[model samples]
Target chain A: MEQTSGTQRLVLVVEDNPLTLDAVVAALDEEGYRVRRAVDGMDAIGEMQQEVPDLVIADIHMPRMSGGELVRRLREWNVPVILLSADTNWSRTAGVVFVPKPFDLDHLLDVAANLLDEG
Target chain B: MGIVELLGVRSAAIVPLNVAGNRRGVVIASSAQHDFFTEEDLRFLQAVARWVGALAHRAELVQQLTAEAAERGRRLAADELVTVLAHDLGNYLAPIKARIDLLRRRARREDRQRDLQDAEAASQALDRLRRLIADLLDVGRLDQGIFAISPQAVDLSGLARETAAAFQAGSNAVRIGGESPVPALADPDRLRQALENLLSNAVRHSPEGAPVHLDVGLEGNGDGRWAVLTVSDQGPGVPPDLLPRVFNRYVRGSGSSGLGLGLYLASRIAAAHGGSLTVDSPPGQGARFRLAVPSGDELSGFRGEAP
Candidate 1:
């Protein structure tokens, strides 16, 4: 099992697209990380209320609160974010990794690994 | 003057108000007494015309600014709509990609060669679709000066066969014929994508049961030695009016149920690889697309005519 900070790492993936969420969660799970799923930013917030994750991967556009809003809320918290975006409007949020849509799964895994390792 | 005399006007002074080279209007002063109007009165009228012109200029500026603001607002709304739509389309593509990745992983783990190849092909096709969705925002990725390829010596004939095998399953049958060992310095995945786009376009246009054909070979001329892949179909060829701009972004045929990105992206992929994608269609015969890249020896590091 993979460990970060001397504990099992938890990654919360927030995407309105069900398949993308499934893909991200599955890929992270394959890497031996504990992954949580959320449909949008509001859902992500609900998950955070239960437990704050080590890392958050969220899409920019969604039904309820957007990933941008979610990142804004997490600004007070020290959790790192990986913003998966297909929209050009994705801003450069500090301490957030940006991955364009239709990305290679390996590349995304590498990014997640680097983020976790660096922390 | 005759009309003025008929109205019993003895003296008349008319001034054409020319302000900033624009003739605003005419001011007329008449009196029963001859030469009753003075130059001072005419000068005053001309000054008023100048004031009117100044007001008119300001009003015109305001109108233009309003129009421009409205146009900008419209443009912003349209852009937002397109981005939202493109993002939704991307969301739909995500699942297909996820399934493909999982299939690929499983195939590799099981050592199923055929399934692995099929999954890889599907992944590449999804890659092209993702680009098409992105192109909805950028219109022409080339216009943004975005052209990058990872090139190596690859067998063009094998690529053609694999591409044909992966693509020719459903709507129409594709027959492959070409010379083997046709090597080129190109990105195999991108090259295959371009070929698939052409093949699918052929399939879509062809009548039921007409086989789409893919052929690969080598050619040489003053341009240079080249490895070429050609896809042709026995369908109603491209119309003459659309031929010149066939590869232009967003140019679609009548009743085309596509985003019109396939051919444009294919052409861009070819150009990025320092190659050309040309189409030949004679009236009602059919369409033949030829894609050619510089020839290279397998693993020779021959960097002739590569981008």
Candidate 2:
């Protein structure tokens, strides 16, 4: 949904899976969010420097940049990240909203909405 | 103990030692053989314990590393979903924009005729993108254990027909082969999705105006009964080297426009039905995908929907 300023909610999704990443972007766009993507950890950090997004959704275990490192780096900038991973202990990641993999679209959208609003 | 007594005792003292959680060689002793007990005995035993403890600790660490490696492998596999999405989807959209630009130029001459064709082509490309994204997202959900397969007794034949029809409406010539009334236990939506993928793949790979054949019937062998659904395409079949890896995730061969999860997801859907999926594609021939479901011992509480 559009924000009070009439701009779409901006989301930065860091995912390495081509199909799933596009799907997430499409779903978020359908939900009225403007989404940008980073395929790996290094790219995510580089993207973060150029754009301060409303929220970040990232998958763990990406090549060149791991999701853990992304979250750790983003935390340094006081940016909020929503960490999504299929790892059994994904919830253990620090200073981020952890969403377990095989996620329900509704739950992810709700969490994303909440995070954007909290900002 | 004397030699005779030691022999009869079966060297109980010499039994294997589980030293400090790590087993080491055993030591046998005979009192008659005074050489058995020496001043060095105490020192040797102490050293053995220390050595075994270190070895066991090393073994434990190795075990931990192996487990970590396995977990990392699984995580990496799950992460590939995003990589494929970022790479392939970008490639797919580029050509569409170019085509659209070409169409716009043609529209300047009041040439609305080819405009519809170009728009339709673009729409088809977009649908491909949509399906790829959907499959990837489903994989993500499956990896995270978030997508639950809601089991129902769906009619397999009818589901196939409906899915085929849905796909056929989208400019593909789909021909339903074999018995039109074939039936089996399945999940309607999932089965439909699988059939849709197969139909789409068939149409995409085959030449324009080529027929995509879908067959459903019962097959019997001495071992068991099976419901067989086959999707055969007249396109240049998959190459020999690529055949083995066709169902593997994220593996697309020549001319593939997708993230390559269609066959993978199709196989997964088949497995969930307690069935099996197999494929055969010899070069320059054709590709035939067969889904076989065991027809023995009907699933209880499942009412098959009639075709």
Candidate 3:
């Protein structure tokens, strides 16, 4: 069920939990996106330095730098961000979509696709 | 003695004041003329003394009642704290333990990711449990007048927005609108926790999809400036009889679960920051809670040093 016919769009998945990181990357890959993985916000920033992704998905709570700090840093890149958080009080930021934990993979992919398409 | 001597009183009738069968003092009546006191006059004087003793006894009774009521309130609060702690702990730990068990059973490499996710969920649940325990302890420390808070400059509006945003999911309808960058002297963590408690309560009581509004701004005039945050929800309004005691520890309104310590702790946090928490609810119209802390020049001398 590959959705993209041309060069696959790249998506960066940043999460501290190895399991969540693996699952998100697998899901995005299955959706026909070139998925790059980062263990945390710092690694994600380094990955971005090498090659900016079309969309960045990061967990809100992470070691070293937080997803929020990453989002602020990515403001200049003008890339869409999807923040995953277990905290209900997570602060909302402009130009970012927040998805709570235990989210449906299809729904997340739809949101990612819509954002990437808009971008 | 002096007045009687000046009046040239030849004699006086002194009766001991007795309250609750204990002698407290005495009452004295005198006449200027010799042999001025009659048998009937002595009886009237004794009667007056009895009335005064009765008044003293009544005052003593009132004092005892007030002390008893205070003690009763504290015991009730302690009891509620224990009950809520047990319930909330079970609520969080049961799921975490179950998830851990699931992880233990699912050991295949292919299931590794799912297990890890379960572990992460369990970890988050543990964090929530920790926070709940901390809140319970804070309430206790605050009651004993030993809770410490370190105050610094904080952005009230940003905090309100952030706290409100955290509850936007799971049947919560929250709207945050007010002046941004509103600054005040406060313990950022404590103030945030207080606001979170208010937001949590508001969301919990609100009808499904009913909007909960959080507004923050600068209030008061001149030297009395205050940073105010108000959280309102369209839930069943608090009962009129329960409104006054809403901040009292262990006082719960109808349809509320938990130990009823949330508002009490929030109120304590506000007081620690030289602020106040208040609530208003008209029957059938929902409830609104306001928290106000001194801001600007008013907080120049504010040092919320932890006790």
The TM-score, computed over Cα atoms with residue i paired to residue i, of candidate 3 is: 0.47
Tens digit of per-residue lDDT, candidate 1, span B1-307: 5887788999877777654577877767778898887889778877776777778778878999999898778666666666677677777877678778877887897999999999999998888667666655545334434335678888888888888886656778899887877878898867887887898899889889889988888899997888998889898999999999999977898747778988998898888889999999998888999998888754454434322
Which DockQ-derived CAPRI band holds candidate 3? incorrect
Instruction: List, residue by residue over B42-114, the lDDT tens digit for candidate 3.
Output: 8888888889999989998999999989977877777565544544443344334434433433433357877
**TM-score per model over all chains:** 0.58, 0.47, 0.47
Model 3, A1-119: lDDT tens digits are 33643137899888876766766776566556898998887898899999999999887667898656878887778899888754433534677898755444545767888888888
Q: What is chain B's TM-score across the candidates, in the order shown? A: 0.57, 0.60, 0.60
Model 1 alpha-carbon drift over 4 Å, by segment: A1-7, B1-36, B140-307
Against the reference, the lDDT scores of all candidates come to 0.79, 0.70, 0.75
Question: Which of the two, 1 or 2, has more lDDT?
Answer: 1
Model 2 residue B66 lDDT score: 100
Best by TM-score: 1
The parts of candidate 2 lying over 4 Å away from their true place are: A1-119, B1-126, B141-148, B296-307
Question: How would you encode candidate 1's per-residue C-alpha lDDT over A27-112 as one tens digit per residue?
Answer: 77866788888898888888988998888888888887856578898666688888887664563467688887766777777888
Per-residue CA lDDT of candidate 2, range A8-109, in tens? 667888888665677677667756678889998888888889987888888777788655566778887676788866543456566788875545455677
Ranking according to DockQ, highest score first: 1, 2, 3
Better-scoring candidate (lDDT), 2 or 3: 3
lDDT of 1 at B248: 90
How displaced is residue B240 in candidate 1, in Å? 15
Evaluated at residue B236, the lDDT of candidate 1 is 90
